[model samples]
Target: MLTVMRHELNMQDRSFSTYLFGFFLLETIGIAAMIYNINNKMANFEYCLSTITLVFVLIIPLITMKSIAEERKLRTDQLLYSLPLSMWDIVLGKFFATLVNFMFPMVFIAVYPLLFKRYGNVYLLTSYGSIIAFIFLGAALIAIGMFVSSLTENQGIAAGISAVIIALNYYSLDLANITSSTKQGSLLVILFFILIIGFIVRSLTKSTLAGVILAALLAAITGIVYLIKSDLFEGLVPSVMSKISFFQRFYAFVNGNFDVTAIVYYVSMTAFFLFLCVQSLEKRRYN
Candidate 1:
């Protein structure tokens, strides 16, 4: 795993991908920080971090587009398949390789809070908390992107799909607001969500029967609850969506609360997606 990680990182650097990613990330964050802090004289560094996170909608796909997708496309996956390492090792190595690339720009970002503290009184707790959230968010998003990459050999397709999913995660709050708030509406939306989950399972596992069973069970339980207590479903979609909003959690830290739950949520999300990514790759090996 360590060897694979080093090789991946070395390849990324040699390809100029790392430099390009770091350059854009630094430039965008620098511009945002300058505008919000230097020009507007904003006291909180958290706002700058919050604003810069928007770049993930683009940067994540860029970073992960070729992680596994390119390997499959170039038939290098056969090399991976023949290697002595387990699927979990390969998946973890690739994940860390992508994460290391992601972390490089953050090293520069880490200095901003200190710079602000030098200038005047800065809320180090909130500033640091927001930064932590920002990195955690990136870690989770990269894991998602890696999963997307595993689904397709085409880098462009992987990138496009990742961009759309990340964009939805970023804007899910607004989408939830626009969706219906009635009990039936929430139940229907939840059913749709379950179907989507089942579809992903089917896609990864190539097992229609299992997917159908999972979807049917989820829909049945949801329907039973909705029928029993229709009023309980009211506004449930928005509540659930709000809870699922990735950006909103970071905002909590920006508001000066170091939310332990938010940190756990981010870490859980990262682990979940990475697990899925590994499974997706393992499926290919077995097939």
Candidate 2:
């Protein structure tokens, strides 16, 4: 695992993606700093953190796009399978390596609070809390990005897919608002989401029977429940979307609440996606 981490870091040093990510980070932080300190004349660093978090949708794909996709593209994944290391080790090694690369700029961003403290009236608790939440959010997204990368051999496709997923997540709140709150509407949307999940299951397992069975079972259950108590489906889609959105949870931190539930949610998301990444690699080995 350490060897993989070291190799990934070394490769990143020679790659343009690392520098591109750095540039994005610099630009995001720079603009946030200008707005908070100059234009807004506010000492709240949490505002800056909130503003820059959206930029992750654009830049995080660059770091994770090549993590596993490049290995498959270059046909090195077979060598990895032959190694004694488990799939989890390889996945985590790559994940931590990408995390380290992402954290390079964050180390500097962490100092912003202290720097602002020197000026006046920086809400240190909320500021630092938001920073921590921001890091966790990025880590969670990176795990999802890594899983997306593992699904394809082409880096560009991985990045594009990841960007779309992250962008949708960033806007999940607005998307949820646009969704209908009616029981029938929510039921239809839930059925659609189940179909999407079925497709994902099929892709991951490469088993049409398994995917079809799972989807049919879930759809049947949803239909039964909806028929029994239509009220239960009322506003279900929007509520679920609001609950699961990563950005929505981060707003709690920005609002000066050190929400433990949000932290747990982010950690759970990170672990779940990393597990998916391991499974994706294992599937490759079997194939």
Candidate 3:
């Protein structure tokens, strides 16, 4: 794992991706700082972090697009499968390596609170708290991006899909507000989600029967529950969407709440996607 990590880091150093990521982070922070300076009424660093959060939809894909996709593209994944290291080791090594690369600029970001303090009254607790949340959010998104990369050998496709996924998550709160909250509406939306999940399962397992069976079972169960107790699903879609939203959870921290639940949610999300990445690689070995 360490060897893989070192190799990835060395590769990143030789490539432009790391530099591009750094430049984006620096530019985002600069813009945030400038905005804050112009509007002295907005003194919180969380505001700056919030302003830059959407940029992750673009920047994270740049770093993670090649993590596993490039390996597959070059047919080196077969060599990895032959190695004694488990899939977990490879996935984690790459994840941590990309995380380290992402963290390079974050070191500079961590100092922003002190700089704000030097200039005027700053809420250190909330500022640092938001920063912590921001890091975890980025880490979780990176994990998601890596999982997306594992799905495709083409880095461009991986990046595009990752960007779309992140963009959807970023705007999920607004989406939920606009979406129907009625029981029938929620049921239909959930059924649609189940179909999408089935497609993903079919793609990953390459088993139409497995995907059909899983989707049918889930859809049947959901249908039965909806028929039996329609009220149970009232406003369910929006509520669930808001709860699972990554940005919505982070806003708690930005609002000065050191929410333990949000931290756990981010950690859980990271672990879940990393596990999926491992499974995706393992599937390749079987194929």
Candidate 4:
């Protein structure tokens, strides 16, 4: 795993995209700092961080687009399979390598709170807390992008797919507000989500029966709850969207609240997606 990680990092070091990712990230933050800290004369560094949260949707896909795609394009994944490492090891190594690339820009970002502290009464503790959550949000999204990259051999497709998903997540709060809040609407939407989950499970396992069973089980449970307490279903869709959105959870930190559940949510999301990434490779190995 370490060998794979080092090799991946070395390869990224040579890629122009890697440098661009750093440059773009820093420039975006710099611009945000100017707007929030300089122009507005706000002492809250977290506001600057919050302003640039959407930047992840752009750069994350850029960095993770080629993670697994290039391997298959060059026919090198076969070499990975034939190697002694397990699927988990290979997936983890790639994830960590990309995570390191993500963090290179973040190290510079970490210094902003200190820089701002010199000028005024900056909320350093809140700023650091938000930064930590921001890192978790990036990790979870990187894992998601890596999984997306594993699905296609084209870097552009991987980037496109991941970017769309991230954009949806970034705008999820507004989407939730516009969505139907009625019990019936929530029930249908939740069922739709269950169906999507079923398809994802099918893709990962390559077993239609397993997917159907899982979907049916979840739908049945949800249906039973809806029937027993219809009020519980009211406004559930927005609540679900709010809970599921990566950016929505990040707002708790931006609002100066250190939410432990949000931290756990981000960690769980990262681990879940990494597990799926391993499963993606395992399916290819079997086929």
Q: Please state the error at residue 21 of candidate 3 in Å.
A: 0.5
Candidates 1 and 2 compared by lDDT, better number: 2
Ranking by lDDT: 4, 2, 3, 1
lDDT of each model, Cα atoms only? 0.88, 0.90, 0.90, 0.91
Candidate 3: 10-residue stretch with minimal lDDT? 34-43
Candidate 1 local Cα displacement, residue 253, angstroms = 1.0
Tens digit of per-residue lDDT, candidate 1, span 199-266: 98797679999899999999999888888889899899888888888888989899999999999999
Residue by residue across 53-155, what tens digits does model 2's lDDT show?
8898889999999999999989898888888988888898899898998889888888988998898889999989998998899999999999999999999
- The predicted structure with the larger lDDT, 1 or 3, is 3
Clashing pairs in 3: none
Candidate 1 weakest ten by summed lDDT: 12-21
How many clashes does each candidate structure show, in the order listed? Answer: 0, 0, 0, 0
Per-residue lDDT of 160-222 in model 3, one digit per residue for the tens?
A: 999999999988888889999998899999999999999988987899999999999999999
Model 2: ten consecutive residues of lowest lDDT: 278-287
In the range 132-250, model 4's lDDT, one tens digit per residue, is 98899999999999999999999999999999999999998899999999999999998999999999889878999999999999999999999899999899889888778999889
Model 4 misplacement above 4 A: 197-218
Model 1 stretches with alpha carbons more than 4 Å out: 194-214
**Worst lDDT 10-window in candidate 4:** 278-287
- Candidate 4: global Cα-lDDT? 0.91
